[model samples]
Target chain A: MRGYSGDKDAYLKRLRRIEGQIRGLQRMVDDDEYCIDILTQVSAATKALQSLSLGLLDEHLKHCVAEAVAEGGDAADEKVREASEAIARLVRS
Target chain B: MRGYSGDKDAYLKRLRRIEGQIRGLQRMVDDDEYCIDILTQVSAATKALQSLSLGLLDEHLKHCVAEAVAEGGDAADEKVREASEAIARLVRS
Candidate 1:
């Protein structure tokens, strides 16, 4: 099972909300809203996505990474390495 | 007119694409995809939004902020300050 399986509904809801925010951006552009206003909304949507990423990452570390660590082998090391890379991507993104 | 008025259609198209990415994320979650895979897609979506923001910010600096600065007054200072704040928010987000 995936790390986020238990929180699937919550994650889906958050993604859908972000999707709505993106659509709102389209409407603002269509109406020729001010540049600063649009940028503000963009920042909000970005924050939302970042928040979601952090939540997922937390769960992944708690469950997936923890599970591998408990198993005690090369797979545990690989999982740690993989999780670190994912965290790097999240930070850079 | 907004700084992005000329590129409204392009901006809307990019937002629509990002919306699609968000929906794809919903599907990934619903299917119980691996945590790492979902995080990877999330980063891709975040990057796309950031790129759009950078494009918009470039146009804002070139047009809106440029015009204000050209006029030479307190408005110009305010506009510059506002843009800087927006940039900071984007970076933090």
Candidate 2:
């Protein structure tokens, strides 16, 4: 229950909408919508996602990393490393 | 005007909501809600994000990568590489 076990409904609700958005984007393509229009949708979708990732990263830092720091030891080091890697991935995206 | 220049309003709208969700999670934390509950929110948030990334990746493959494949050459290679890197990052996340 410590990992990915909470707020399932809320997450699912948001994801369902995002999924619809993606499908709508596909229709735009199938209909041969302007290339720029499609790219714009893609950008918007990606930004929505990037915002989500950033939020998760923020939580990880506040909770997971902070907990590790309190414990003090290898767990602390590992959590920091994991958080750093997550940050790097977000940066690259 | 090619990249991320289309559907700007739609993108902004979606992002705004996702932002609200993140803030909700943060408030959950500040209130000292159960760790698992907070984690559940984190999981939900991360999954939402992963879904978004996957959508963008899908569009990139269908449109950006497809265009490059049609051209065939250094540009093709670059586009494929970029797409691949994006995939690798998503997978890792």
Candidate 3:
């Protein structure tokens, strides 16, 4: 996750904005915003969240995961499994 | 995307596997696998894909996007817009 660590501040900022958007969406629901509108916002938030996750996963695979594989320990397989499980969870969700 | 470039070969291999998984999912659909099973596989494939995307996005934000922002060019804003739009598209899907 070397790439991830390089610009930590900016990434966190984006995440904060997305977090606020999610809260705003929740508030919209509380205020009885139109169904489609809420759904639309929900979709946006989901995408934002997904984008963030995608970025992190990409870094993991490119850096940490790859390094682990190169190192070739029990941890390497564990990392692979963890990655797979993460994907599984995403699909199940 | 510096981190991504560093281990390109390994990353491509993982992508190849995911690609195969997606093809398998398509075949399952063609064969009319049970709806739940098909859905399960679809979900898994989606998650696998999302994971891959997330990793790449993370690298871009950390490396490419961050460098663009740091350089302070028109490209910086363009990159930001691209990222936002990417997120929007994901949500819409």
Candidate 4:
């Protein structure tokens, strides 16, 4: 079981919503919508993805990392390191 | 005709690819993939959206905003202001 397994339904819903947003962007382009308007939608989609990332990260830290820390071994250290790297990627993205 | 009209097909292709990425993310979640792995894919999708925004913004500045500025009127100022606001939103997102 993964850290996000419990929230799987919620995460899938968010991803599907974001998928709809991406489709909306394609439609806007097909109709020759104004560039700024398209960019605005792009920003909205990006923000949604970012929010999802943050939520997943929170759950990973709270569950995965916490469980590893409770075990107190090299696996715990590796999990923490992996989570940190994921956080960095999320921030930079 | 919009600034991106010339690149419409290319833009559509990119958006479609991002849509695919979003769907792939949904699959990852449904399969109970590791949290960090899911986060990685989320970052990839977010980065793709950002790159698409930058491409569209560049074209907008070169065409829409440029044409308005060349006309030299209140509309030009408004276009520039709108572009700036869009840039701000992109950065904040």
Q: Which of the numbered candidates is closest to the native, going by highest TM-score?
A: 4
Model 1 Cα lDDT, one tens digit per residue, A1-93 = 888888889999999999999999999999898899999999999999999999999999999999999999999999999999999999999
Judged by lDDT against the true structure, how good is candidate 1? Answer: 0.94
Best by lDDT: 4
lDDT string for model 2 (A1-93, tens) is 222235445544554555565667656645556444554565555555555556555666777778889999999998787767666555654
Fold similarity of candidate 2's chain A to the true chain A, as a TM-score: 0.86
lDDT of 3 by residue, B1-93 (tens): 373797688679988988898898789888988899978887787777776766665555545655565565577567656754554454434
lDDT of 1 at A56: 97
- After aligning candidate 4 to the native by TM-score, how far in Å is the CA of B22 from where it should be? 0.5
Give candidate 1 misplaced runs (Cα > 4 Å). none
lDDT for each of the candidates?
A: 0.94, 0.58, 0.68, 0.95
Of candidates 4 and 1, the better by lDDT: 4
Clashing pairs in 4: none
Instruction: For all candidates in order, state the fraction of native interface contacts they contain.
Output: 0.96, 0.02, 0.00, 1.00
lDDT of 1 by residue, B1-93 (tens): 889988888999999999999999999999998999999999999999999999999999999999999999999999999999999999999
Off by over 4 Å in 3: A1-3, B1-93
Q: What DockQ score does model 1 reach against the true complex?
A: 0.92
DockQ of each candidate's interface versus the true one? 0.92, 0.06, 0.05, 0.95
lDDT of 2 by residue, B15-93 (tens): 4555555667656645555444444554555555555556555666677778889989899998777666666555554
